[model samples]
Target chain A: MKALVWHGKEDIRYDTVSDPAIEHPRDAIIKVTSCAICGSDLHLFHNLVPAMLPGDIMGHETMGEVVEVGSDAKGSLKKGDRVVIPFTIQCGECDQCRRGNFSVCERTNRKKALGDKAFGHATAGLFGYTHLTGGYPGGQAEYLRVPFADTTHIKVPGGIDDEKLLFLSDIQPGDTVAVWGCGPVGQMTIRSAILLGAEQVIAIDHLPERLSMAAAAGAITIDFMQESVVDRLNALTDGKGPHKCIDAVGTESHVDFGQPDTVLDRAKQMLMAENDRPHVLREMIYVCRPGGVISIIGVYLGLVDKIPMGQAMNKGLTFRMAQAHVPRWTGDLLRRIEDGQIDPSFVITHKVDLSKGPEMYATFRDKADGCVKVMLQP
Target chain B: MPLTNVTGVARSEGDPRVQRKGPSSLTGPDRLARALGWFSVGLGLAELAAPGRLARALGLDDKEGLIRAYGARELASAVPTLSIDKPIGLAARIGGDALDLATLAPALHRDNPKRHNAAIAAALVAGITLLDIAAFKGVKAAHRRDGGAARDYSDRSGLPRGAAASRGLARKDFDIPPDYRAEGTVADAIPALPS
Candidate 1:
């Protein structure tokens, strides 16, 4: 089997590796048909997220036809069933999973001790993330070994495009929602907010292409470089801040002259002093309407500096953030896709073979040549 | 066994292992930059730890402090060279190479007893300087983002009924999860609630 393996910072290789086999009664093997290069993958590409060992396969957004199934998973999954493997591995029997908190399901992290040390408590194991999450080889290959297969997958019907189904691994907005960053996730978030009945969806980004995409979804666009994000957001809301602020750009906020704090954050990040650039977090807190909600779907790796907790406390804001408990929404989202309500395929801008995965990583990281999202077919 | 096999104790018995390596995302320049970065660390540590020995060999016995300072500079340059910010570290390295050449020039005078050693050192610096320049240029060219007309995605609304009709479409079938609802907090529902 060939897979994209993490060698070091900014080094991903399409290497030949041994094929996966069923290792437990709950494990299943899938012949991966499609996978994607996620924004969070860039964190690993840049070596920002720790505990990534060499030879680790790299990918998470994936779906495939099951080729083999363990005895325990046979009741729910079987050979030839097409399924989208959510990134987070979960034991359905856990208390967290029963409560719909699948991202923090208690029994999934195989390296629980290491995870506990790094995160205070071990969360769910994630495919291809890091050792702190489980160190499971990812699905960026011809095949993948899925642990807890019975409960960790979203089964999609045939006759749908893989592009629409691959994103089941990852929203809603009410009132006026301001989404920061117009990357792929940000674009999906904009459409979701509109579908979820937000009166207004304001997308913030400096890139013209992204702004145009956001505008297509009927969102008012703010080019932070051209105009003030804070002022424009306020003006759009009639001087009241947006009701909900969504941060899609997490650890690696774009560093620009307009955001001086981002520049300082970059410097600190280079010096190994800061884990995240929270420029967006600071802005969200400072500008969110009093008594408003802050919904963060973005992935924050670790510690962040200089968050305005005082403002959030005084304003009585509510902060909701997590890696998507994918199963919680996938069934409804899948129905929406089937019903022609929302199309997930709109976000994919680049499609290539799995061998080109290495170059695609660079193109996506540099945001070069109008590259937005890449889908790799194996 | 690969390092991952040893350290990834959590991995099950049937997981994949590397069979053969292939082309990497890392370009030639990136590998060169990394090699230069490690070289800098080694040379910098040697200079810092035995500046007196280096000065004596080059017949610049009075310049131990200067050599140590250059060592610190080398180490500082390595930080960025080894980081994702390779260009910055490579630029610093190029500057440090110039300083090294200048310092060696004085030691290369014929009157010095160890002029030959100084000349050898100067040649080595010059070689490394060329490599530094190459790595710097290669890295910049490899990662350069040229500005142009961006690919437009304005037509991709991803809504079959159009963006307008799609608004609140999901609300017809889905209610906000109770744990996730933000609109009806207890304080908002209760007018007499304290701030």
Candidate 2:
């Protein structure tokens, strides 16, 4: 089967990799119908992200049909059912999963999710990456092998639009991260403050499109390049600051907050002084109202640039951080999507076949095209 | 607590009798961690294979757990007079083959069509007897680590059931030492699903 494979530095290509099949009674093999490139994939393009090397399958946001199933999962799903799959492969009955933290399951991402020795490096995940993960292989190919078939898959409603459901994997949850970062979670820390239900959701970004999408999602848009986000959010909310303040832009933003090292060419790589790190997170802390919770989903490698712990404590703020339990949110989110409360697919600006992703990757890496999301067809 | 099947609220449909067995003598961490480890390995592969069924089955549990663990008990006990709904689909037959997902996948798919699934299907996966409404209510603030004064949380707002929840904590709000702490922190309720 042909899949979009990521070779060494900046080299993404479409090649015929071994096809995927159900090898376990608990497994289900899905034929790829639709997949997309995530913002994080750009990390691979820029060589900033490190994990699986060349020949690794890249795309994660995906939806497809069941071609085959192992014995145990057969009764729960059968041939020909469309489904939305999450990035974090998890078992439904684990302790962490019981608490709804499936992403950190001891068996999935052997090294990171459970730690190397816990599940053993090889005990974890899918295609493309090295054997460190189960290396069972991943979706970005003609077929994807899904483990824990009964617990990890989401049956896509039989007749909904595929385009709308594609983002269920990581993007929507990431978007939810942004929403929470700026909304309800933010409100948790800032008491009596307006919430994400605020009339204006302040989408902060240098790009017009993300800002536009944020506005489309009912937020007031703030282009950091054009206006002072702090000033604008305050103005929009009557000096109380945005009901919720989300940082979708993360450490990549120019003059990025919490980035402590200035010596590097750009994008504060090294971090020694906590305060020297850009002040955005802290600023968001300040921008938050008293008692507001801060919703964070940004990819901060380790400790944040500088967390305004003092103010957080002073204001009774709480910080909720996690990549997202997409499976956990699937049902409710699907309902919301069906109900028309949210339409995240509008974020997709580019769609390409597996072969075309290389150019998209290069362009996305150099910040070439205005690509919010690139959906790849196998 | 071990939950037993007893007469839940006899609804318009029908009620099932579930007996409260005892506090769920749930497994300890080590045991749970091992089970999770094995399940994670197996489930991850299932996801790569049968993500649709995988997601559906997962939702079924959490939904059921949420319902049985919270709603069932609350509903059944609150309105023992109400009737319960009948179980169908894979639910029709319980206590057999563990309703194994791998095996169930074929049936569920055979049951539906159209590119994996494009429909919403929910079922009553488990029975409930005692869902403490109070337990679902969020009442955290264990940070009083050093005997610092425990903040009075008996009057928080913006929560669906905050006032009611806070009212319960008012009595003990001051009793807890500032530093007196509890275990893990949890949300009172699932946030209104992300829009």
Candidate 3:
């Protein structure tokens, strides 16, 4: 099978790898139909997140048809079922899953010890993520072996495409979302917010093309390069800020301001003095309303320096963050797509074969050629 | 060891034949302790693999060897926590936490170049140590409740024949079909279905 393999910092290769087979009773084999390069993938591409060995398969966002199912998986999933695989692998029977905190499912993370050591707790296994989570082979390949298939993958109904349902795992309805970073996830978040009945959506980014795309999705776009984000958001929300602030940009957030802290963060990041540049997180804290929910879908690996916790606590803010629990939202999102509530394909600016993964990763990471999202057809 | 003839059937938690051992399988604190055990292992490996990188990230690059040594200690602490069924391993972790704090005390000084980063790292370690203590207390309470008879099953073999043998039960084996069912015609079948 042809797949994207991670070699090192800024290096991804399209290589032929062995086809995946069902290794567990709850596993299923899927023939991938569509996959997308995620912004979080750039973290791996740049070698920011540790534990990524050479030849680890890369990619998480995917939809496909089930070609095989283990006996235990037959109870819920069947061969020939079209499904959307979530990034987080969950065993629905775990205590966390029962409580709807599927992203931290206790049973799925094979490298639980490592995850616990790094993050204070083991995260649920994530596809294509490094060994911090279980090093599950990713979906950016011709075929994928999905573990905990009965509970992890959502069955998409007929007459709906993968693009329309892909973003359902990230966004929810009734959220006044303020998204930072107008990348692929940011754009989809904009569309998903609107579809989910968010009264107002604020999209922040420096890129003209991405802001324009956000505007097209009925969001109020803020160019961080041109204006002060905190001021704009305050003025727009009558000094209360949005109800929910989404950090779509993760650890590698670009800082448009020349503030000393921002400069230090960037310099430290460059010199490997720090693993993350949390400019967006700080801005979100400054811009979020009192009692607002800060939802972080962004991928942050290590400890961040100097977050404004005092202000967050004094203002009574709620912080919720995790790798998206894809299955939790996939079923409903698929239904929404089938009902014509959203068309997620609008975010795709580049569509190429699996062989172009290497070049496309660079293009996407650099935000070159107005590329917002790249869809890889394997 | 196989104690029943039913090979493929999923074992229910309520099954009386299966003896409950180790940490309470479903309690919040037990789960947390297990997770902490894993975390210690993971962090230890990272420290051992690239002490220089870990030092740099923590703004203590000058103490690379110390970081590597701490990683070794972490790995040592993690094994007992992960492998042992007793609360003693968690207690050891609390001791390890104190050592870490003492090691990090120098980095907290105002004169340190990366004092802010070091402080953050220390705060994180402190928070984890608190969790370790909480988990330790929970495990201790559970241990007392179980009358200190919670057998350490960590060293048990692939099959548990001793318990069944003591009860005069004969082990039975049965053939179970592998779960995977492959369908080569899925793509063709999908296209043939009516939209």
Candidate 4:
């Protein structure tokens, strides 16, 4: 099987690897049909996520056909079934899963102790993520072994294309969502927000191409480089700011100008003293309206420095953030896709074979050639 | 007597009553115990493979021996649970969890340099302990309900009922023609469908 294997910082190799097999009874094997490079993958590419080992497969956003099913998974999945495997692996029977918090599932994280030591708690196993989650070999390969398949994958309805149903793993309707960083997730967040009937969607980014993509998705774009993001957001929403703000940019946020804290954060990051540069988080806190919700779809690993918690507290803000519990939203999102509400494929700027993964990672990370999302076909 | 459908949906195709005997004659909690059995094996391997690294990562480099001993215990606990269909192995796991908590207690002291790491590790162990106890109780309850019927298959459904029923939607709702290329430029792959 060919896969995008992580070697080190900025070193991803499209290499031949061992084919995945069903390791557990509840596992299923999926021959990947479509996989996309995500902004968070850059975290691994840049060596920001600590527990990432050499030769770890990269990629999470994917959909495929079930090539094989284990005994336990046979109840919900079968060979030849087309399914969208969520990045977060969950055993649906767990207490957390019963409550729809699949990202905190107890049974999925095989390396719970590492997570416990790092984040004070173990998160659910995330495909292709670092050891902080379970180092489940990711979906960037030709075939992926999905654990807890009965609960982890959502069967995609036949008429709906992968393009339309891909973003269903994230984003819900009627959320007055404001997304920061117009990367792939951010662009999907924009499109999903519009489809979900969000009254308003504000997109913040410095890139021209990404902002244009957000505008194409019916969101109000803000070029953070040219203007004060806080001021623009306030002015756009009649001084109230957006009802919900999303930090689509995670730990690897970049700031061009040398603001004191951001400069210090950059210095710390360069010195290997801090793993996260939380500029987006701080900005979201400052720009979001009082009592507004802050939803983070961005990936934050290890410790984050200098969050404005006092202000967040004073404003009575509600924070909701996690790795998308892909299964939780898959059903409704697929239904929406079938209903012809939104098309997620609009975000894909480049599509290449699995072999182009190395080059595409750099292209997406560098925001080169107007690339917003790159879909890899194996 | 057992359901053998591809989707595993035929709950006892031959004898519906047998489905009620519970998964593998083991209760729901016992299944959880079996899961923990595998978890112990994974954890044990990590500990045994690199005790010093694990110890340092946990801020307890000085306790490498203790960590290795705990690893050995985890390996020991995993054996009976994996080999037998009894609840006693799960019960032993609960006991081992208690010992683990006791061992982790010292690291929770405010004065300890590694208190934060120790606290997190202890909390994790405590959580595992609670789960072990819950599985034990579940197994016992199932045993009482069935009057000790020794079944060969588990009764619990692996997938949610709603999700299972909707599984056919993939084949029913949309179809990607065999020749359809999902790759290349997004504009070329999926042209604007008539709105």
What are the lDDT figures for the candidates, one per model? 0.89, 0.46, 0.71, 0.70
Cα deviation at A252, candidate 1, in Å, is 1.2
TM-score per candidate, in order? 0.93, 0.57, 0.64, 0.64
Give the 10-residue window scoring lowest on summed lDDT in candidate 4 chain A: A167-176
Q: Which residue pairs in model 1 clash with each other?
A: none
* Candidate 2 local lDDT, A37-93, one digit each (tens): 765565444344334444456666767999898999988899999988787778777
Q: Cα-based RMSD of the predictions, in order?
A: 2.9, 29.2, 23.1, 21.9
Task: Quote the positional error of residue A111 for candidate 3 in Å.
Answer: 1.5
Residue lDDT tens for model 3, B70-110:
88888767755653242656887899899888878888888
Report the lDDT tens digits of candidate 4 across residue range B1-195: 111122222211111011111111123564577689899899888888889997776666688998888888888777655532336567778888998788778777777777888888899998998898888787665444221112111121111222223223233333333322222322222223354
- Model 3 regions more than 4 Å off: A168-176, A256-260, B1-195
DockQ of each: 0.50, 0.01, 0.01, 0.01
lDDT comparison, 3 vs 4, better candidate: 3
List model 3 lDDT by residue over A334-364, tens digit each.
5545544555666777789888888787667
lDDT of 4 by residue, A80-152 (tens): 9988878898988889888778889988888787667667888898888886787777888788888888988
Displacement of the residue B177 alpha carbon in candidate 1, Å: 0.8
Candidates by lDDT, descending order? 1, 3, 4, 2
Q: Pick the candidate with the highest lDDT.
A: 1
Per the 3 Å backbone cut-off, how many clashing residue pairs does candidate 4 have?
12
